[model samples]
Target: MRFTTRVLLLQLLTVVAVVATSTAVFIGLSMAQLRDEAETSALMIARTVAAEPEVRELVAEEAQDEENPPAEELAQGQLQQYAVAASQSTGALFVVITDQNGMRLAHPDEDLLNLLVSTSFSEAMEGREVVAWERGTLGESARAKVPVFAPGSDTPVGEVSVGFERAGVFDDLPRKLLFIGAAALLALVIGLIASLILRKRWEKLTLGLQPEELVVLVQNQAAVLDGVGDGVIALDTDGVIRLSNGAANRIFGILDSENLTLADLDLADDVVADLEGGTARDGVVANGRVIFLEARSVDRGGQALGSVIVVRDRTDLMALSERLDSVRAMTSALRVQRHEFANRIHVAAGLVEAGRMQEATEFLHTMRSRGPVDYPLVGVELITEPFLQAFLGAKSLEASERGVSLQIREETLVLGNVAEVEDVATVLGNLVDNAVTAAVASDELRLVEVTLLDDADQLVIVVADSGPGITPGADPFAHQPKKLAENDQDSGQLKDHIHGHGIGLTLSQDMAQRRGGEVWLVEPGGEKSRRGAVFGARLPDVMEPDDSVNYREVQEEDK
Candidate 1:
């Protein structure tokens, strides 16, 4: 049920319980008061009738009947008349005078004069006032008995008994209780109906939102994000992951929610620390390969609530950037080739105008021999323009200038697409440049080896150099500047301070990741005296069977 409905029902039930208890207590107290008042009124009437002078005189006349009362029978008749008058004066239902033997003498009803009095009258005649229920010709009644004594004597002559019908006192009580109960029940029904109506109205106003709405909203948002190709991960202030898009899950190979955490995504330790420390930070990763984690404080109305971390996958963007760099390099090389070709045509035109046929033929032959041709590597015909080849050749020469021997190992068995030829050249160029710089200070054999091989389902390009391998203890991709001095033979503490803080491997690694691949430093062997860094790149194989044959023939023809 909706929240509003549940709240309304709970409130209605509480009101009902309270009203019921209160009504019950009121009815009980009212009945008790009425009962006490009825009892008191009955006792007062019994006492007043017993104290009547006629009652006293009747008792006296009866006592003296044995001595001087045959002539006084007329006086006794007058006393009996007075006793009847006293019974009428008290508003009791009935009054009877009973002698010591429990026999009625004077009664409100004349026909009841000879009737047997109740046992309660006998108890009263023995000097005790008695009150009890008794069955009479008129049904049951509450009877009170009081003893009458002779004038100025303590001896009981008879008992004056008074009765009041109990039905009258109890009659209105049930009706009043019924009225109160009806009111309570009516209030309860009205309250419940009001609660239900309000609940329905609330549900309508809220657009029928329930607990399931929250779940559905979240799931829908996640579904929309999952369609995106870029990885996205979000985390709350506690360093606990809140959401991860499909791309992110696949990139990290996180198939289960249980293994996801802030640390697993290569988020900066300080950023994680700040989240743990309740601070907010936002920045991009240097390489732009892994997710870039940025944290910012979440707030409401100027109050600091928590922090939110947004992760963006820059892998594809980085690849696009590398492709752009390759295009630029190719463009530059093509511009140079155009200029050189224009100069050669001008020189040939001058030779033909001077009528130097032999010399012009020699010049033509030299130009043809010097024309750019593609190189073959790893059985793959290098389909790139001559300008790119020249760029790589110049980079190789630069490495040699730095005392680093550039070696190229060609695999004769593999062929792959040249779609990324410019990009491959750029990547190799950068690696050779960095290797030359790193190997310049090494006392060991400074050699940079570029090897191409075909692995199952992919083409692997390995670049290994004889230089100090990446600092063994830390992450090879750590964001530190390149060490300026390989040997600590510099001036002072300042030299040591500036060493080992570079971004070469970090940059190269970022490039490798952009091509749907990775770069790793191969472990060195125990027997090998050379200690250097080895970087490898793996690209998807795009060579067809016919292309493989042509590529192999091209390499053979080159040989």
Candidate 2:
């Protein structure tokens, strides 16, 4: 049923219940009141008749003499006549007078005259007045019995009985109930009208949405919000969080989704203000994850309803982008090497065709002595591992193109292969690229030094450049501003856009930290250290094989 209809029905039932209960109580009380009034009037009439001097004297005479004649019983007849006149005038059913022995002296029914009363008169004889419901010869009535006292005496000589018919006593009730029923009916009609009005108002309040529609809306909202990977948060105009999806709750680290606001989450004020203001913020970090944020204001009929915030996590996308950049750099270096090798081959071919056979042989010998065409750098050969050798050679080519000399330290010694080549590559790639940039910008001869060490438990990488060291009072590893570089176009976006400026170092540290390792500046760039800022990365669980264990085994056996 529609909500308004249900409300109307509920109100109707409530009013009916109240009216019915009230009517029942009122009917009972009214009936009792009317009956009591009848009894009181009857008692008053009886007492008045009994107080007459002539009636009391006659009753006293009748109690003294039992035998009497119709013609001689003049005083007794007078009392009977008076009672008949009183019964008629007062609208009583009947009025009777009896002696102390309970024999009637006067009765409305002439045939019942001079006979014992057909109802109890014991209380009246004992000098007490009584009023109650009783069935006599006159039928059931509200009757009263009072003692007939003589002049100037409290003692009773006889008794008077007065009765109002039971039917007559309830005659006014139907009329009274008619009024009551009419009032109740009118009240019910008014209540129904009020319920209908309230129903219409309720319809307007709920925008005419039925209970079933609201149910469907809730179900659909849950389905859409919970099924999507993106986080959604809806807030009221007052900035109170009204609805939060499962993704939002999980992303914001909220323990409870209800009755929460952005302030409750202790978010940065600028972020909260931006969200409330319907401004979009991109690449925000929360709970150690990168989030892309979009805010939209919701309005209906030109009224501001609230705002909705959509959040997309960019952490994985950023990692993938970083890997792609590394691959692209490698590809670029390979292209350069291929072009250089092609030139050398062309020269050797030309030399052979020109009849300079000895020189061509010498050139072939020189090229062979130089090892692989891809491994152009002499210092890179110190690291015999093919992947690092190629990676460093590629970086060397990239550095040389930028007028920066990139070289591997002579003391660098890594015997076994790196366990996780990607991790080492990512950290080393970022460090080398950043060093190259710093070196290229320096006034002195651009030079960068790279050192690689595998100490059985960790792979340690250090990169130092001959350039102006880290800026004063700046933390390269910490969060930095996203201010656009003066050469944003030329410099391009770094491998880690999430970290903004100095992204290379920040992302390198993040990647290193993820592998139970750390990357930090071992030395800031200054005169104190000849090499500019020297950064070191210690990656755990990524080391060459344990050759020392085998060496120890051999030594033990010999012993």
Candidate 3:
């Protein structure tokens, strides 16, 4: 059967059982009460007859006789008349007067007069009263017995027995039982009707799906929600998170998402607005990660069902693109260096061809003393590390391609090699990249100046650009770009894949903050003469100490 049908059947059965049991108990109690009433009336009639003065006098006169007389003698006597009168008046089945010897003086049946009574009357024989249900010659009945006292005396001479026939005792009870049965039937009808209504409601609520189908649907939903790589957040119409899978929790770096709304989450305002408006947005930073989100409302038959957001993480992809940009910049610098070498070689060849060996030798010596100058960056010889040299060189070449003069300040100095070069690159590269982009967008002289300072084990970097400086007293990190749809003009690729205005900067700040450092704005740089924005960062424990243990050895040993 269908789910609702089975449920209705169960509910109906339950109601039926309950009503039936209650009706049965009520019938039992009613029958008991009727029996008690019957017995009480029978006892009251018996006592009334036993206390009758004429009936007592006659019974006493009969007891005075030494020999038992034939019941026919007193069958028409006053004792018989009283028994017959009491039986007729009270509607009892029989009213029998018995001597103390348990012999009946009068009975409804004249044939039973003078015979020993069949049912127990011992208690009544001792001058006491008794009431009970018993079976006698007249069949089962609610019977009572009471002792008769001699006229004006305390001695008991005889007893009076009164009985209400079993059938007669329950005369009105049939109507009561009939009413109870009718009520039970009505209750059953009501229960069935209620069950049918409930079944209809259940069908509507479940869309008429069977239990097995619902189970399969739930399993499918679980698989689809949990098996996907991208994060999915399902919300109710109230904007409360109803469902959040493992990927979503992991992406947001939270342990639970129960009952949390968009405002409850640590999301940027632009991200929140996109979610609330149900729009697709890209390159929004959340929890220091670049995530592209596509949000849309869910509805069915014009009923608003709420909203859903699919989040795609792009941080790793952006990082790879940045590395690719670095490689491309390095490649361009190599081409420039090769072209310069060719010119120098051409000059030497011309000197040698003219038989000026001395000039050629001096030129070669001068080149050797000049040291490696492949990088186009100014002051390339100040730093000794090969990685930083290549990195800054690539950055300078990149800046030059965009018409910006990228140079290290004259005061830049360092005491030791950068210990965590990758960390240094992550923080420094972001600041310099932002500065270069800002300088390119400036109306002032397109120049970006970088300075590096080493104090203890900390490395400080500052990048100033001739951009339209930040607003006064405004947080530079406050602005978030909702989406990046522009293409990289030079590379014929979507630049949104490689960068976002706030995303990279947030990641840089997070990495620095993890090491007890910070990135801050030194100068908003929109003053009359200042003309540009300057950003600074301090990264601790990134400098190699003079007497430090070998980090590589420890890593290898741990592995």
Highest TM-score model number:
3
Q: Candidate 2, residues 1-559: lDDT per residue as tens digits? A: 6668778899999999988888888899999998999999999999999988899888888777867434325334987899999999999999898888887778887776767788888889788999999997778999999999766777777899999998899999999899889888988999999999888887766667788888998899989898899998888888787888888877777766677887786555777788877788766656556677888998766667788889887766766677777777667767776787899999999998999999999988876655456453547656766567767888887788888888788868776677776777788888887777777657777888988887776888988877767665665654344443553221111222334523555566767788889998787765555557788899998766745446466447658
Per-candidate RMSD, Å = 11.9, 6.6, 6.4
TM-score of predicted model 1? 0.51
What is candidate 2's CA lDDT for residue 164?
Answer: 94
lDDT of each: 0.59, 0.77, 0.77
**What TM-score do all the candidates reach, one by one?**
0.51, 0.71, 0.81
> Lowest lDDT 10-mer window, candidate 2?
488-497
* lDDT by residue (tens digit), candidate 1, 118-200: 45465776788877667775567677788888778878887877776777657779888888989998989888888888878
Clash counts for all predictions: 7, 1, 0
Off by over 4 Å in 1: 1-18, 21-261, 264-266, 274-289, 336-391, 397-405, 410-417, 422-430, 440-446, 454-458, 477-519, 524-528, 543-559
The lDDT leader among the candidates is 3
Deviation in angstroms for 209 in model 2? 2.0
Q: Find the 10 residues in a row with the least total lDDT in model 3.
A: 488-497
